[model samples]
Target: MQVHECVSFILLKDNQVLLEKRAQDKEYDPNLIAIPGGHMEHGETREQALFRELEEELDIVPTSYVYLCSLYHPTGELQLIHYYVITQWTGTIVSLEADEVAWHSLEANPLDIEADKVALAEYRRLSLSLIIL
Candidate 1:
């Protein structure tokens, strides 16, 4: 099985978090809300991959970002997901790939939305440090 690395960013503003709904035609988790991100290119570093994915999917460039954590799944095809918190950015958001995008209450229950629960929990758990960093 091939191992893949994926990067995601949680963009926050005024206590709300930006989320993107996956296109209905997408192969995995169609119509599910998720953080903005994609697979890393062959030679790209984690930060490079995050920047490229954010640009491609949201048409914005992060002015500053803080590494949150990584998740690894060993079942079936191996997957390693790197999570980041983007404190600032440049350019207006344009949904280039997601089906829909919106800002939801940061304190909202993750189960109430179609997002990645694990990552959401991690973000909430580290919200304080993330803001301080």
Candidate 2:
């Protein structure tokens, strides 16, 4: 099985969170809303992975972040995810690797964005994490 290591950040500011709508052409389910983060590369720590993903996907440099948790999933496909909280960021958001970017209110949506709900249970358990598959 292919092992995938990733990270997702709950980027919040003034009660709003940064949400991205995945492109329709994305290998993942279309338009799924996700937090800002992605896979870890070889020899990369969780912070390194988070930084890389943030710059690659959104071109934003985070000013501050904190490790929140980690999860290992055995969803018939093994995957590990490192979750974090991005409380600060620099450089205005100018990249749109996703189909769209929106500053969403925490109360506006139900916060269910994953296709494989069970695999993402860990995130739901964390009050600060936005769970996903």
Candidate 3:
């Protein structure tokens, strides 16, 4: 199995969330909008991987953070992603590794990731599940 340790941030501010348009250079999710994160290199923990990925992708560091949940790829790849809530952060957004970035009011604007149907389905599941919980 192709195990990948990935981390995604819920970059929220006053109930808004940030989503990124994937760079066309990407083969896996080109032209899609998704969260900021990537695969963990060998020997890295989930938190370390997340911090490194967020810094590389978004050019910011969190002032406070915690894990929200962990989920697997539908294909059964292990150690898929640990979702983190980044409610507080430092610095500005620059050096964007994505094609574009947008802040969405998730409550009012539904976010979408075009090429990543699995992740999108996961997002939709979370959205619906949150309403009842």
TM-score to native of every candidate shown? 0.85, 0.75, 0.77
Enumerate clash totals for all models, in the order shown: 0, 0, 0
For model 2, how does the per-residue alpha-carbon lDDT over 16-86 read when each residue is reduced to its tens digit? 77777777886644567766566789999878888888888888888887676666645445667677767
Root-mean-square deviation of every model: 2.7, 5.0, 4.3
The number of the candidate with the highest TM-score is: 1
Q: Candidate 3 overall Cα lDDT vs. reference?
A: 0.69
| lDDT (Cα, tens digit) per residue for candidate 1, span 1-133 | 6878888888889888888888889765567667767889999999999989999999999998888888864433466878888879999999999988899887773332323567777777766665544
Per-residue lDDT, model 2, residue 128, is: 45
Q: What is the Cα-based TM-score of model 3? A: 0.77
lDDT of 3 by residue, 56-106 (tens): 988888888766666775333454667776778888876468888788875
- Which portions of model 2 show Cα errors greater than 4 Å? 72-77, 114-133
Look at candidate 1 and tell me the lDDT of residue 98. Answer: 90
Off by over 4 Å in 1: 73-77, 109-115, 129-133
